[model samples]
Target chain A: MAEAEGEMSSLLEEAAARRAAPGRALVRDAGLIVGAALDMAARFRRDGRLLAFGAGASAADAGHLAVEFTHPVIVGKRALPAISLANDASAVSGIAVSRGYGAVFSTQLRMLGRPEDIAVGFAVEDRCGDVLGAFAAARQLGMLTIALVDGALMDRTLVDGTLVDHVLDARSGDPRIAGEAHMTTYHLLWELVHVFLDDPAPLDGPGTAASGCAADATCVTCADTAVPVHVTELRPGGLALVDTGGGTEEVSVALIEARVGDTVLVHAGEAIAVLGGDAP
Target chain B: MTGALYPFAAAGGDTTREELVMSTAAKAAESVELRLRVLERLGPSLAACARAMATAFRAGGTLLAFGNGGSSTDAQSVAQLFLTPGRGGRRLPAISLTGDSALLTALANDVHFDVVFARQLTALGRRGDIALALSTSGGSANVLRGLEAARRAGLVTVGFAGSGGGRMAAERLADHLFVVPSSSVHRIQEAQATLCHVLWELVHQALAGAEAGGVQAGGEEASDGGLGAGGVGADGVGAGGA
Candidate 1:
């Protein structure tokens, strides 16, 4: 019993010490990136968009970040003019097999990217032809580029000609952070960029963005015309009911149904159900 | 209050050792306390990471999660927290690297284990993607290889590991390493899961706040776009290769 008590005490102390490690360094770097992101937003106001691409975990990051821009929880947000190059299956496969992986991002950038746009690459390091190609395209297009990399790969000169404006390096090699850290980095970036775009303070005057044409306090999706939508509660396998108010018309009930009070995305008067809820 | 509310108290409940009440209560308290401690230590780093993701997201990027075995489940958990909201709002875009069996099996069968993640990285990765990898030991060959791929691809590399940081800690593959400081897999996993959940909450709060204020993260509204069934607010089409 005494030994157990001592062990417990030691554990508690260790946990406390671990908890106290300062995060100011990480936060500061994050701040710089956020500032850069805000600049990107300002450029976007001039009709520019942000483009992201990656493979595997990196690919997942590209897709995940793209989603946050497209859909938000807060009421009255607008869809950002950004795209994830990794979200298209045919495009990626066709490019990968025909042109090789290096051209994947560059190919997309050539057709869609503009000088006002911002291009970002998420990698543990700053090598590889695909990453280089994308960066080169961004540079050639006179677009701003940023790289998120690990400390081991922090030498910005490797990319040449200031291709990367900011580098957030963790200086650690834990594989989990390969995913976990991203959740942290991008989440912060998303918030900081929003702050610049919205100027949350009502005292800051009007925001630059326009409002959507939805009926609810939280509706962010808008169309030129008000499409009628009928929402109904859906039950799948007699498990539970889901509300489909924010649902789009093409929402597939093959997995569930549309329901009232459910937040949904509507396009052309069809119920395109969002994931989560009752859909299997 | 119900009239019968005090029945148990009025009966002077017999708290006996045979009931295992004492040990159970003690254990629960200890668990809660340990969790609290872990959170306290990791709060700032975790919060900062979330903030970073929010920023990247507003700028248009992707979030990718990967892990092995139960840790793979952790990756899935991370993906779900963003892609699907348990309550309030809609989904966000996120993916678990372990979600597809065909991809995993094929990679393992056709290529070396070290290339599992790297190959995917080469095939799908580009600039501005976030590569998130999880490994309790921080020494999984595939995970290490994946992180290398992420780095080479210019993806933001992040990791979650245990012990004195293992190879993940010493090698610098991750831009951020959150170590559990313990060799016990159970304890490390528990803490990591908790960290992921907290991150989910933070991301939601930040994004929801931004959207409510009528601001766009990626220059778009926060509501209608998403990619997966997990509820990430993705737009047009589904997750592609890798």
Candidate 2:
């Protein structure tokens, strides 16, 4: 009661701070993330689907990311296959009751996922032990495993591990921040994967992504990015000379503000929006 | 390829000096505006929503929440935040309708998909309870049906919506509605988070005041306690509660 006077401001600040942790992390790992997404796009071209799962707060993340893929909010964007394993309440309880809480995610994957499909798991601390189990199951099936880990315990196992192909770390311990960061990371991944898929050169003309890794569907590659860069300057006619990881790329920022140094959301050939803001 | 990949045009890393400064500065601007807008225009509605929540909790009512996609996650977040509040706040009963996969899939499969939430409501809602619906577009069919169902079951309804509140505002749904006027979904969600947090705080604060004897109470039950007499059955899960 006595603390009510400043409670509003304090709470608002905490929310922003929580959002900031993941926001910054996603930006720093932009290149690595975009590369991982490019690999994911290639997988999708081979008719691979995405299966997302988590527990507690991260379960919501699984659902949110799944919906974004299954039903693209952006117009004309193709709907990719994605499923949230946590969407079915009865299946969850039955599995948790029969097997254990740690069995829900992996059990669903064992039933539904194929070797070509991708598994996205989110774990904050040790709260959701099944994320690891899901990864283990996905690995056994030779599916690509992408994990978003918040705490050191989960990170220690998932990062640089063979079981998970992609491990994105949020860098902060706040559970809320981890959840928020996971949202942005997935959103960014969704956008970039679309960008690569829309390009269609690799899938349409030559042997599809099903060729090299078709047997195991696990050979992934990450080139030094050609478009992942910061706009150095906005020239006339919606063009930007951006500093890429290795060199520079002249890109169109017609959709978003042609601002200098913004992390342009380059989808297909157009800069859809500046990262962290909605499409303009 | 969709045109040639944008050729790299700048030399050296943009990271050394300019990118970090400008990106951080520009990106944070919209969020700051979002915070300011919520802080300035959202206080009154948040107060009302909190008061409603406090009244419902006092009457031993449960808060039932529903939404779709990101809003669904937010709905669950709201429930989690309320049910297991950090600090020294009292634990309140709240349910995210989307959390139960079996019940949700069962309803969606058995009945019409749009009626999933509404069906849950019909089974569980009581007169003294509250239904909080979150939809960024504010026009999600399932959410609308759920609101109607809650109203029919004598529950108070509040909604978190975006961009002119969509049909929720147009159709005059929600006894209490807080609309994030922004068109950007990210900003809208951020603003909604602010409002939800503020509402949680305001309700906790009010409860603390009443519990501390700072506010005099009317000894008798607040009349119009809204059908609390014929509430949920002995199990409190209603007859058909799945």
Candidate 3:
């Protein structure tokens, strides 16, 4: 009896100790997390939908986050638009079967993502190819990309500013601990986003970039207008340089097949469709 | 276009950026503190439950998990953790009852939403198997029905609930019930996830000890010997009709 009691205490102590570091780390990164929440609120104000995806256990996190946003539990909390790419098993499986597993999330993002949308990807480890692919597709769509990843990803540069705009690290070697920390971080995100949204003060006051809108003209991204532009050069990572009549600008051509000299409809810094005729 | 359209400057407000950051930090700290307290309070019961689960697993029993909303996703995660533990942890047989949307919707549409999990448990549960239910509110109709079904089917019923275990505890539906003493749904869920993780680890520990001790078969005997004689008897572990 004594031995069993000792074993239970030891197990409990170990479990408690394992989770401490990750929780402390989350508290330490509160500033960054709040900043990300502010940005998310800005996107939401622009009527941007949140698209979240992940693989394995992280898939559950994606669904959990989506449901929280789309169906607010607390009374008086407004429901923000959100969807989990991992929720539809048929779509995920079909995409995997036709284009391979790595293309599942990217394909969905290409079809569903908009310029003002927010993309949040979760991964217990940094090595999930599907998550990285989805981030690439999100960036190409001019969506604000956020990554919730394990501590090992903190040292990696693969998900740098080029792909993910905000990276929240769980900072735990153990997957279970990291997963718990991620839940806390995202819960904080959901709460803070509401806080910012409910606050009367404008998120982007006088000096800041105009609501952090990627487009330069009329905020057409939120306006749901697509303008025709001529592609001048194709850049790496699915980016294309386009001539918008006023000046040259860079846009994402990931959704459609676009080549240099091709006229494409650019909306929210992304080429939505390729026009067959000459640039207007 | 104009500054009027894009008003997101750091202007004067009752709540500044620093205050928001501080609020977030405080929430995180509160979550951490709640988790620690819950673990400290429920550690013994969790350990006992893990031993029971290990025994069931050794006897070729499968784990069936169910819940609602956020708890539903958490149930799926718990199943995934056991089915594909990774990191050299042994794979276990498990299924999330919430995985099949079609069946769930059908059951809810045809009969009622409250019986979604209950109907699945009635069909799948067997003697000595494990039924793990999660509910942040502790009063989810579907979760309560699922536990009742598991108990009827002679399965080892375990529940993770918040706000004092509600109907599950009141009715004594679960042989083992771990409740997070929090009113906030988010904090309850975050702590529940940690609870599941700790339970998973403890089960693995018990299984490893069993393997090392060379007690392969006879699940009840192995559990009794491994846990120490009379330490956690059949009644204490609720060995499902033993």
The DockQ value obtained for model 1 is: 0.03
Candidate ranking (TM-score, best to worst): 3, 2, 1
Select the stronger candidate by DockQ from 2 and 3: 3
**Which ranges of candidate 1 are over 4 A from the true structure?**
A1-22, A125-129, A158-161, A200-280, B1-242
lDDT of each: 0.55, 0.66, 0.78
TM-score for each of the candidates = 0.40, 0.67, 0.80
The Cα error of candidate 3 at residue B163, in Å, is 1.2
Cα lDDT for residue A257, candidate 3 = 92
Evaluation by lDDT, superior candidate among 2 and 3: 3
What's model 3's overall lDDT? Answer: 0.78
**How high is the lDDT of residue B178 in model 2?**
87
Candidate 2 per-residue lDDT over residues A1-280, each given as its tens digit: 3455455446545555555545555556765565467668866865779999987667777888898899876666788999999767788889877876667777788888776688998877556556777777776665778888884444355765555777788666766556655665676677657656765333222222221223243222222122345667775545566655555555556557756757665533345566642222
Residue B239 lDDT (model 2): 17
Q: How badly does each model clash, as a count of residue pairs?
A: 131, 11, 6
**Which consecutive 10 residues in model 1 chain B have the weakest lDDT in total?**
B228-237
Instruction: Assess each model's interface with DockQ, reporting 2 decimals per model.
Output: 0.03, 0.10, 0.22
Candidate 3 on B1-242: residue-level lDDT in tens?
A: 11121123234445666666776788899899989988999898898999999999999899999998888899999998888766566778899999898999899999999999999999999998999999987899999999999999999999999997899888888999998998889999999999999999888878877776786833222222111111212221112221
TM-score of chain B of each: 0.75, 0.78, 0.83
Docking class of 3: incorrect
Quote the positional error of residue A243 for candidate 3 in Å: 13
Residue-wise lDDT of candidate 2 within B127-199, one digit each (tens)?
Answer: 9899999888888999999999999898889988999899988997899988988786766775676567667
For model 2, what share of native contacts is present? Answer: 0.09
